[model samples]
Target: METTMLPAIVQVLPGDDFTVYAYCNDGAVRLLDAKPLLELGGIFESLKDPAFFRERLTVMNDTVAWDIKGNRDETCCIDLDPCVIFRTAPIVDDPLENVI
Candidate 1:
């Protein structure tokens, strides 16, 4: 199956449960859990620090990214592919919906 890349991430909101609320340019929202990735270690190890993990999230290169360099250098940055994230992340209901 051919897979197309999802829209760029416009916003990323961190949650208490190691999940992130990602808003895409296409008007889709998804909840992504980082726990599994964090367990793989390596660069992801730095995310073990809750404060650093939650506060350093950013949207870069059309995907979810983190600036671990503290200086905003690309060298210490990590990003997840939007296509993959869109496919794997759980879909979230739009809170703006009005219910009677």
Candidate 2:
């Protein structure tokens, strides 16, 4: 029998197009396209602003999150499920790999 552990997000980098690079505990860098969620409106509406999206991007509650209130309160922030991101987002080369 085999058991799989859910992925834990360690860091996140937001792209201008609403994509997020989620770096997980398993050493996987997955890319998440957040446009779909933004289309849903409501609380996610605030993230439509590119500046706000990138500025508020953070890792909280073990996943990619948007700290809209500028506070690290998990309950007050919007977060994505790490499991879903791990399963759906394709693994990509680390964007920071070539940084000096």
Candidate 3:
């Protein structure tokens, strides 16, 4: 028997501060911070450039992906696992916190 995978990403919206809001097929929205991942270096190094990072964000194969070449190929593509993304904590902003 084979296990079934969860719903894929339906949409991705890139935000400032290297954050992305992802909407999944499961009817869930998740927030992912790329700051930490960018610190890991390697292929992620290229993403340190905010412009490059934001411009290439896209939803592919039910996951959040970035294709450096914009060709949608495996070689220059970087993706975040949908399962892990779904489990990530969402970013919440409290407007009242700024009030004194």
Candidate 4:
């Protein structure tokens, strides 16, 4: 529910430069750090765990935004919450669909 101020700095893991992102809406974030999978031979279970992602991920916002400082596209959704992956079905549309 925070706004204006950028969130805290998250650390980057080994391998690809992907990082996490945090925003004010829906306490959004994304775990862009593609390290664990790379380290585990490209198979990291946490990526697909519903509860785990729900516990550590967030929706960020209905619109797509990126974390400038994150190096990667990771971002924040909640304190450490997961996201509702399928809730986006009804909202998916062309980029210009909602434009003025």
RMSD of each: 4.0, 1.4, 5.6, 14.1
Clash pairs, candidate 3, are 9-62
Candidate 3, residue 39: lDDT: 86
Two-way TM-score contest, 1 vs 4, winner: 1
Q: Which candidate should be chosen as best, given TM-score against the real structure?
A: 2
lDDT of 1 by residue, 3-82 (tens): 86556888888876788888887788888999998999998988888888888888777678888876677656888888
TM-score computed on alpha carbons, candidate 3: 0.79
Candidate 3 steric clashes? 1
Model 1 clashes, total count? 0
What lDDT score is found at residue 98 in candidate 4? 75
- The runs of at least 3 residues in candidate 4 whose Cα sits more than 4 Å from the true structure, single-residue gaps closed, are 1-16, 20-25, 30-32, 42-100
Mark the regions of model 3 whose C-alpha exceeds 4 Å error after superposition. Answer: 1-5, 91-100
Task: Point out the higher-scoring one by lDDT: 3 or 4.
Answer: 3
Off by over 4 Å in 1: 1-6, 94-100
Give a tens-digit lDDT track for model 4, residues 55-99: 343322333222333333455322222232213212222333377
Q: Write the per-residue lDDT of candidate 3 for residues 7-64, one digit (tens) a residue.
A: 5788788877998888777666677888999989998998898888889888766688
Ranking of models by lDDT: 2, 1, 3, 4
Ranking by TM-score: 2, 1, 3, 4
TM-score, structure 1 vs. true: 0.82
